[model samples]
Target: MTVSITDVARAAGVSTSTVSRALRGRPGVSDEVRAQIATVAAQLGYTASRSASSLASGRTFTIGVIAPYIGRWFFGTVLDAAEKVFSAAGYDVLLYNLGTPETRKRFFTRLPVRKRVDAVLSLLIPDEEEAAALRSLEVPLASTVGGAREGFTVVGIDDHAGAASAVRHLVNLGHRRIGMISGASEPLHWTTPLARRRAYLDVLADAGIEHDPKLEADGGYTVEGGEQAMTELLAASRPPTAVFAQSDEMAMGALRALRRHRLRVPDDVSVVGFDDHELAEVIGLTTVAQPVTGQGAEAARLLLEQLDAPDAEPPGHVQMPIRLILRETTAPPSPRGPQ
Candidate 1:
């Protein structure tokens, strides 16, 4: 026979309702009583039915995670770290990958995740329409790798600051003609690409460097895109002496492009990238390193806290720190090169 809640309650000398509250992690019971009830339930091999518990507590014991592309290094790392935290807390994860425009449209239109999770975690910033749809669900929401929305808690690094730091490094190395390979033009409200680009331009202006539109290229945050963008920049009448790629993958692509064109790195053009991917050290690529895993874990923790106490104070934003990693990829522009 299956062990029931009644049996556990009788063994622990508590009412069935008290056992239910304690087991569900609700607030009507003392810590000592809850611990005793858990111990008794474990000893008796008693497990509450999820359906019945959901009906009683109005919670699904699950979290819904939404991301653009999980295959990318940053997204993959963040999702993995967040999943570990949710699993340890006995919560299930439901992932939604909106990698294409069609999928994004379908997801926002249908909102299939409604009422299926205790909370939602977004790894990317949602557009206005998407944000509205998410808010309609009325669930606790949080984000990582994006700016704070009106109703959602956010955990991420300062994109503008990171970009500014990269530019400053290049400037300190005597690079005046700097170029940038930025993300593709989509998800205009995502803010990462926009903020970074704005900061890059601002830093150049402040440093008294002429900002040349011809030096900018769209890399789409990928290796192949970076290579293509770098090639285009090299073909320009006046190529920049230093190139800052928004991501490490793109930076690697720039290196390949330079080689293909018979242009030596640093010797011909210096390179810097953001998001210190695992290969950065192996390739000696200079980059801005942010706490990718830490941001995910912290976002998960914040959402869990909100779920635990919905009536608690409003959740605040978390800004993780970033640093510039110096490597062999960046140096003073060689005098032998045309400046």
Candidate 2:
């Protein structure tokens, strides 16, 4: 005979409602009590029917994760960490990645995620229309991208500050002609590329370096794109002695381009990149590192807290810190560097 929740409650010496909440990993049950209830339920062969539990609790126990691109290292890493946090809390994740603006627009138009999730987590800042659609979901909302939205509890790093540090490091090393492999144009709400580029220019101005259009190339935030950008820089009448790629992937590409040209790093062209990607250490690329996992986990936790007490907690922003990790890829340019 299949054991029921009531039988587990009786065996655990707790009320049926308490047993239900504890078994479902809901609030109002202490960890000790929850553990004991879980043990009792397992021993009694009690398994929950998700549909039935959702109907009774009026919650789907699902988190909708929205993002434009999952292939990027940053997005993939964040999603992995956030999924772990949600899984521990007994919640399922629904990914909403369509890979293009057209598809995303069409997906949001119908709002298929409506009433199907207990909370929402966005990996990208939604536009006004997208934001409106998300708000229509009427669920706890949080984000790990951009600054605080009107309704989202955000957890992310300061893009300007992080990028500025990378450029400033090159400037401190006496690199004047610093080229930048920049990300391509993005949507209005996707302001990371703009913020990082602005920092690069602003820092150069501070150090008396004149802006050169020839020094900037669109990398599209991919390895091949970055390699192409670096190749463009090499073709410049006067290539920069140091280069800053907006992402580590691009920096890796830049390194490839330099190697193909038989040029030595730092000795010929010092390179810096943002997002100290996992491969940065192994490849000896100097980069600005942000707490990618921390941001994702904290954003998920904030959403969970809001789910626990909807409309009780004020939405807030968490500006996580970033640091520059100096590695072998950067050094003062050789005296024979481009003039």
Candidate 3:
């Protein structure tokens, strides 16, 4: 037989009311007590009765998390952070993986999450129509690592500034022929790829360097795409002296391509990446660092704020800062190069 809520409450030495409060993630329960309850309940194989709770409170006591892709490291980090936050708050999480427009349309048009979750947390999906459709839902909406259409709570980094910082660092190192591997094709609407590319172009123009179409490559925000774009950029008869890959994964791939071409990083060519992923430090890659985990937690907290008080202040945008990590991958152009 399935474990009963009363059994869980008895195991945790709490009353049925306390168990309900802890399980519903209702306010007034201490974090420690809630954790204890959750542990005991799990040990007893106790699952919350969503139907019963819905009948009583009209809430599923669940939060819906949507992301464009779960395969990316950054997106995965955000999802994990959000899950932890919601779990701590006594709420179950429902994940929706809508990577393409068709899937997103079907999800919203179908309203599959109806009566399933209390609020929806979208991670950097910025399609205007999708945002509109989601807003049509009666539930609360929150976003992390990107913005929404209008009247939504969003937490994300300042992509334009972050990109400018990365490119500026390269320019400060006297790199004039810096090429970019941009992420223009990522499904996420508010991703920083195109902004970074724009920053690169703007900085290059500001530095009085002629923008060369031959040097830039569309990397599509993946390691393999970066590797392929890097290969193409390196194959030019007059290759760029430096490159600013938009992602650390891409930078790693660029490093591989450079090694394949018998070129020494920072000696023959300077490179920069974004995100400061773990591998970036291991491989001594220069990149822009954004607080991804913090963004996730903050977005969850904001959603909780709305949940706690429905008639509270309206949601607004929150932009996180970025820092440049100068590692061994970036340096002045080689003396033998085009001077």
TM-score of each: 0.89, 0.96, 0.86
Worst 10 residues of 3 by lDDT: 143-152
Candidate 1 lDDT over residue span 199-302, tens digit each: 89999999998889999999988899999999999988988999999999899999999999998888899999999988899999999999888988998988
Candidates in order have lDDT scores of 0.90, 0.89, 0.84
- lDDT of each residue in 61-129, candidate 2, tens digit only: 899998878988889999999999999888899999967878787888887788888989898888887
Error of 2 at 336 (Å): 0.3
Candidate 3 local Cα displacement, residue 248, angstroms: 0.7
Which 10 residues in a row give candidate 1 its minimum summed lDDT? Answer: 183-192
**Which clashing pairs does model 1 show?**
none
By TM-score, the candidates rank as 2, 1, 3
Model 3: pairs clashing at backbone N, Cα or C within 3 Å:
none
User: Which pairs clash in model 2?
Assistant: none
Cα misplacement distance, residue 280 of candidate 3 (Å)? 1.2
lDDT of 2 at 80: 94
lDDT of 3 by residue, 1-339 (tens): 988888998889989889998877677889999999989998888987867877877777799888888889888988988889988876888998888878877887887887778899987565777777778777788887554448678888778788889888888888878889887877756556767788888898888888889898878778898999999998887888899888888888899999999999989999999998878889999999988888889889888888877888856888877899889998899989853
